[model samples]
Target: MPNDKGRRRRFGSVRKLPSGRFQARYRGPDGLMRTADNTFATQTDADRWLVKQEAKILDGDWTNPDVKIAFGDFAEDWFKDRDYAATTRERNAVVLNRFILPTFSDLPLREITTPQVRRWRTDLIEAGVGAASVAKAYQVLRAILHTAVDDGLIERNPCRIKGAGSVTHTERPFLSVPEVYRLADAVPPHCRALILLAAFCALRFGELAALQRHDIDLEAHTVSVRRAYAETRAEGLIVKAPKSAAGVRTVAFPASLAEELAHHLAEYADAGRTGLVFVGARGGVMRRNNFRRIWLRALAATGLGDVHFHDLRHTGNTLAATGGASTRELMHRMGHSSVRAALIYQHLVNGRDHVIADYVDGQIRKVKRPPHGPSGT
Candidate 1:
């Protein structure tokens, strides 16, 4: 049969419609002729479209053009089908509602383009969002789009901006040994061991908050971390397993702190074996906001400037590095799943290196004076 160009065509046909627009049609793998989604301005344009459709079908990348899936529906299903912890679920939902969905929710999966992704990230940064928050939002968006690509809803993911999802880590402060103890003493009598354990044991605030009388072994000088309390405004405190398997291991504290730990439990802890090790002023479950008030007062009393509760754990990790703890040991102590974070602490092992250098220098001096040194006896 003659094509709309008034010539014989090989495998597909292009015809000029009554409206004078060129329509492309080709036999799909199902042996049914499929029309292009959009009409072209010219017959050659329609022919080019038909060639692409044939290429896609032959390449096994054929997708039904009739099915139009919106991004919002797909992304919500993606979020629901996964097995996420309660805290992670809450965070993903927040990220979707606040950052991801507002931009691409109603759009078709195939319609999301690289330019749109780049512009969306730029708008977020221009809108005064923090770099870390924007990075998190970008990561969530990239993850959802990646699922779309894998599902064959989109040919490729649109989130391809280099370094768009990475945030530079700012250095956080860690207190010295004396500073940790001073801050501990500045807090209430009940909170002394809290400070000591935080700075020495390297337990996260969440892990520390979830600690119970049974989790501590004064005799072993070890604290078992099994669960952690993850709290969000939408969801109150959620007791969940540690984020990683490494987080579930036991951490040994300095033997010197065992007495203080025992004393804290005896004097202030709840009456039962499973009682919360750290409780609120009224002996109820402790929340971060409530404990933060105490932390601030202690900081003020010690004249320490703006210390976050998390910094105590960082301090402990630095101290571990100073003791020449290996990367694996730091990972275990920090409850980190990877050596990257542990390596940061190793880089901060200034004290141990100095001691080694001094010891080596002393040994060298003791080695029969280097070939007629002027000041040597």
Candidate 2:
């Protein structure tokens, strides 16, 4: 039991107040005495708090409460530190301005709590935000808060909702080999090779759109993916390297495609080593929106409605799996850095176990029958 006397301590002091409470005061880095806002019921509580404050000061983690930065300001700085692609930067900016800033822009970084984060996420969902959109916004928020934690702006990240950043997508449609060819024939004559290459080579639309005449070696039967294009509202068309290091690989094509690709290049593709291989009717970049009508018409004609253009690549991967391609081979052919997408093809091929089972049944039948005589043979 401390009396009405005060005891001097290193960097601070603890005193028993006349109201029968213990008060703690410390000299801040600004050379001013900062007293605890409320009194502690026990002298031990007051001493513990003062010791913690001193430890923070000694460790250079003490932040001036009055000069704390706003969440928006810190987040802006965090974004500027990274060199993001144009499309990615535009997407992050949209989420920040549309979802994050409205809720916690003015709040100081230190003031945000886990409950506040949970409430904000709930509010966004209640306001009719799509699950995917909410997930994206939450991801951006978590990234910002994660950097805040690293910078010592806060002790912990408030974005702690498990699985809050993941968006669940419905199964994508898959196309059959005959369906792929039907759709290819239904499209315009100039785009026949484009559809074939997309389905057979598993090349993404961006990779196909950015292909140059020099990238394809008909003699070598390979296509080199050196660059890719991204269409963004702000930049219109931004050309960059492949999304991953593995994406910049040379993929092989069937000998049958060599003639078709040659014909397309000679007749339709722009002339020059750097000439665009797949362009619009008027020799412009093939924008998806501009060509959507043509694609839709082809789908309607082929009776393959609601199939996305990307499903061509999926179909190609499925065929590759059926052809006995290994996981590493699929990864290389599809230009994927991770095995996650490659594993999907593995799962798809599991359906072919019925063929193995049928082969086993045939073997069993052969054993059950009597040995064939020379005359029967």
Candidate topping TM-score: 2
Candidate 1 residues 1-377, lDDT tens each? 24455444686888878787887778877778888879998888887887877787788878886678998999889988978888788887887899889989999888889999999999999999899889999998899889888777788899999998899988999887768867876888767778877888788888887899999987766788889988877778889888886687666666556667777888878878899998878887777888889998888888999789999989887777766666666776777876444443453354433332233233324433332112211
Can you give the TM-score per candidate against the true fold?
0.80, 0.82
In model 2, the runs with Cα more than 4 Å from the true position are 1-8, 11-24, 35-48, 337-377
User: Candidate 2 at 216: error in angstroms?
Assistant: 1.0
**Model 2 TM-score?**
0.82
Query: Can you tell me which runs of candidate 1 are displaced by over 4 Å?
Result: 1-25, 30-32, 35-60, 338-377
What tens digits encode model 2's per-residue C-alpha lDDT throughout 2-112?
A: 456998677699999889899999999988888887899988999999998899899998767566789989988988997887878999899999999999999999889
lDDT against the true structure, per candidate, is 0.77, 0.80
- Candidate 2 lDDT score relative to the true structure: 0.80
Give model 2's clash tally. Answer: 0
